[model samples]
Target: MRGSIRFGEFLIFLGALFLFWQYAPWDIFSALDRADLIIAGGIGLLICFLLALVSRWFALDELIHIVALVIGAGLISLSHDVIHTANWSWGDFSFIDCSGGPFSQERDDTYTHALSANAANPNIQVQVLNGRVDVETANRPDYEVRIHTCVRGWDFDHLKEVLDQTYPKPELREDGFSFIQAKPSRGFGMSANVEIILPQSASYKVSIDSSNGRLLLENLSATDLNLSTMNGSITLTHVAAQSVKLHSTNGSLKGQLSAASLAATTTNGGVHLELTPTASGRYDVRTTNGGIELDLATQAIGYAVAADNTNGRIRVNLPQFTTQGQSRNHLSGQTANFAAASIQVSLTVHTTNGSIEIRPQ
Candidate 1:
């Protein structure tokens, strides 16, 4: 977010210059007419620059010099053709058509390239420098080689070239999936993202470590799944696993563990787990510093269930499970008999400082 003081000062100076030019408008027919625009622009730039000096001299204390520098940079970006463009289309239209038609063609060009390449090889992974990755492996073949990537800048061709050079062999394996590594000189941030897709029937696994960026998993059917993030959120959709573990620090973790045993934990954060009634699976749910939710369905069977937390509430949802409590310890009682059942499932839930809710589906 741009600082308020810098924008305010720039707007004030621009307004003052606009009023001055209005009161004593420069004559267009004069010899200095063409030079007048340049002079006016220079004056505006100077004034904007002076705002920084004034702010510093006055020791505004709160507003620093960097803000003024940013304001000056904005002035340079707008000094040419901006006023004329604004004047020509000022009251007629409230919005500028700056959606990258003629002013920006690189965006369209690159997007087209990306679209084509992505369509051709959606399973390919792209790791951006200081940015997140986008993995599209779902419905694609399971990759054998693990890919770790680091990419920087907007040059996709250069990145692709570097990737080609780095992984010259493009190692082919029995499994169609190929792993590539792409890491950036800088790390993940707000603009960073990682997208991973896997074939619905493929037995595979994926783990992500990110900071302040999103991790998206779609249509992944794997035996084991692990996802972790710091100050970021994770969204997993249409994923079925045998065992899944998700953890975050100061970030929300949410997803469906349809056919797998689920465990999650967080510090100074909250967790939400959803098991659809249509979901027939065994779960071991746990958390710390957050609330826990369980969805009970007809297919849920309990051989042994455990929900424990130090400074958090524990709630379990079971239609056919018994409950027992003693002092500060909560115990379970069998509500239904399944002695002959072949499947033995369990739920282990724990927390340090949060609430737990186990409700019927």
Candidate 2:
């Protein structure tokens, strides 16, 4: 989770490692000697560190996790079988963080702000560092956005200092407004939850990028909407957009979405989309470790589907769906009247280690 990892999480990791050491078979890892294990871990660490430094994908915060992992692996592998036989008291595990963390809601202070802009076609861009973004469509024709951010820290002084210094206010632009920002040093324990409200009468170009926060957009129409979160879920409800790109590295994507052109991918999560492809469009969705559930509007448009899954089952249910190729893990077909329909949709969905279910709405 990059910047989202905390000391308490490390405590949990140590606890798990202790449990595994006490119970798990040491012979499974006996295949590798101490020198071999050290060499292998060193090579992996070097490669990962170089990639992390060069790609900018992994931050310094992630380095803490990587180092912890290498240490844990080394420690477990080097430990002898006697460790499992050693008697350990329950008090040794008291360091586990059952309450999440030291920072609590009691130490948090809330702040409210509003940002409004006047534009026929507005562009609303929001970037969160370590919190959440929730955008909704409202009746306000003035293109207004209301923000509620919580500033938190270790104690009262830190909370007050951060709250006084930071407020999520939009910066006006020639096109519209941008709420993008870098994470503050004092924002370590903060929750920069930004709630955006878009006008129903106007179309927007919205872009939101969060490093470690959940994203939610509902009942919003956009000409172009881009959303990406590194470690949180992305949810869309009754969203209609001309172009939408959703990417989440560690979270699921589930909801009702109507996009003319869509490309959504998640590395470690599932995707369940109820799509209303009202017109000609191309949709692509991919996930690595999760299942995919796609429900299309049966009568609204014609669809040419190509869906695939590895280590999972595939099912396609549609009225008058012509099957070109059908197998346990692959399905390619089209609607009955592929050419006669006014609107046609081309969908490509793929997943690994999960099932694929495409059915008619």
Candidate 3:
């Protein structure tokens, strides 16, 4: 009532944040502490004392108001799992251990499972909430998947529980195979890596989404491929796809990529790609905190590009590229139309804090 944030309101918001971050009282800062009731009492009292003076000075709320706010905050903390962590993601910030954690020893075990495949459009869709995803193409006639789960826990049993929850459940149907790992198990650390292998099909598709681990995609041909992760690097090797989309929140994009159309974006990471020469192709790659390197080697290739970098230099080294507009960090132009009718490429690459280089392979 005194200002925008009432005494009780602020306390409520704080309580909610604590719950969201899984920060119990005892584990206020430690990722391993979990004595709920005991710590919740101290936390509630601290909140009460800390906010009382502020409310008195700013809001000048009544004594009853301060008391009520503290009581409510305490209740909230006591009723929750105390999902409060110091690192509450706000604008490109995240915890070091993506899987809110015990931070104990790390272990990983690998196993292979044969999957059901569709005769027509065999697709693989993997969603790992807190681990890496790798996919490769094999000459085998069947579908197979390998899982490697790694994470920290209080003990062997706790670790097993976390790993069990992180394992992906792949379901196969006439359409394709889909697997989604449940959110990191409730009370322990959780992370898992997945590797999928399958024979090529006429219309195979690969879609992988990960919350907090690197992704490696190799030797796969698909009509459409979409790979994304909240915070990890992405690598593509000998990948052949008609259409591809790659994204990351805090990692780089690297490796060889071949596609008719490709779009990649990242934050806090660089984009380095060696694109296989294709007659006709469209590519767009951008990053916020890293450099962009693109190389296309083809004597007969003709390309039109618009490259921009906010805080670094831009260089275009293609002999055939004629610069129409140039600056320290921006370039836009295209090679003469005389390029052989066979090779035509259009590219857009941009970065905020790194240089942009386009060299002929």
Candidate 4:
């Protein structure tokens, strides 16, 4: 969190210092002495520790806090996984698989199955992003697919490259099916990156959460869709549905809407939506560190907007409609003049740390 560039420079400086102490022409230390190696390492660590302590007084403590928070959270998550293993097991040997770095690169035998979208189905769920998940589907689905990155064990850069490759253009297969290498399936590690796609007519409850990848819902007619993310954007575009919900912890939310009833919330993220005049649905948008933009083309029965930003602004634009209602500080009301308009909905918008704009599209 110490600004990546600064951290990189620090690392290079440490490397240069070690090189000078170890191999410089000047006779400083013997290269073959094991005790010298330990002493050198200790000295290097001491330098780093001193620099860390000095940084706390330069308003850089926040950056250190962010880094510590992420590392702590990751360790806690891993611990949770370990504690949930069967029979109080430290780890599950059979189901566990190595994933995400070089060893994950190898491709094994592949298997695939496809079904008709028109066939009878009770539920269909789709998750097309970065986490490992077990997917089950019964509808004809077309998902661009790729195998998880394979980095050799203990090679951080190689492992990072493997993760970067997850976004490659998906490879298609016959019969609306395809397969790719599973991520980090080294011998017996518990990591996966398989995704499922659902048909348009599929009316099943769905939840997709990705930490480092975008979550996009487009041209879908479904009963319900719930999406969440931490470091990626969330988009709901041209979706016509009964119930739609989205949550983004630290990313943007921007998309088009053809639905009448939509609800979304975010933290430290922005929200933007363009609604067509023919679309009249309930809406709820919020953010803690970002702004909100709401454009209502048609008449709406209720309008409630609460925009709060610790370090941001709020801008709302409401055009004159055929009907009018009460208005106050942060709340307003409008007559449902477009009752005959098929979309009966409520409107809720909020934000905390960024700008909120509601303008004409």
* Best model per TM-score: 3
Q: Is candidate 2 or candidate 3 better by TM-score?
A: 3
Model 2, residue 319: distance off in Å is: 1.5
Model 2 per-residue lDDT tens digits across residues 1-361: 4235666566666776655443444333322343466566677767765766666543554765557564565556345432321112232121101011134332233322233455556778888755667788777544455555554433545655655566556775545678865443422334455666665777788899875567878898888989998657788989988998999876788899888889999987899999887568899999999999998887758888899888899888877888999887889999887788888889899999999888887
TM-score of each: 0.50, 0.67, 0.68, 0.52
Residues 246-355, candidate 4: write the lDDT tens digits.
87765677877655567788775677777643344567777776777766555443333343344544455554332233233243433334344455445656555566
TM-score, structure 4 vs. true? 0.52
Candidate 4 yields a Cα-based lDDT of 0.47
The TM-score of predicted model 1 comes to 0.50
Candidate 2 accuracy as TM-score: 0.67
Q: Worst 10-residue stretch by lDDT in candidate 2?
A: 92-101
- For all candidates, the clash counts are 33, 0, 8, 29
> Tens digit of lDDT per residue, candidate 3, span 37-131?
53665676676666675664543455545555655555554434234222224333333343444454344444344435545556678887666
214 Cα displacement, candidate 4 (Å)? 1.0
lDDT of each candidate versus the true structure: 0.45, 0.68, 0.68, 0.47
lDDT of 3 at 170: 67
Q: What's the distance in Å from true for residue 210, model 2?
A: 1.8
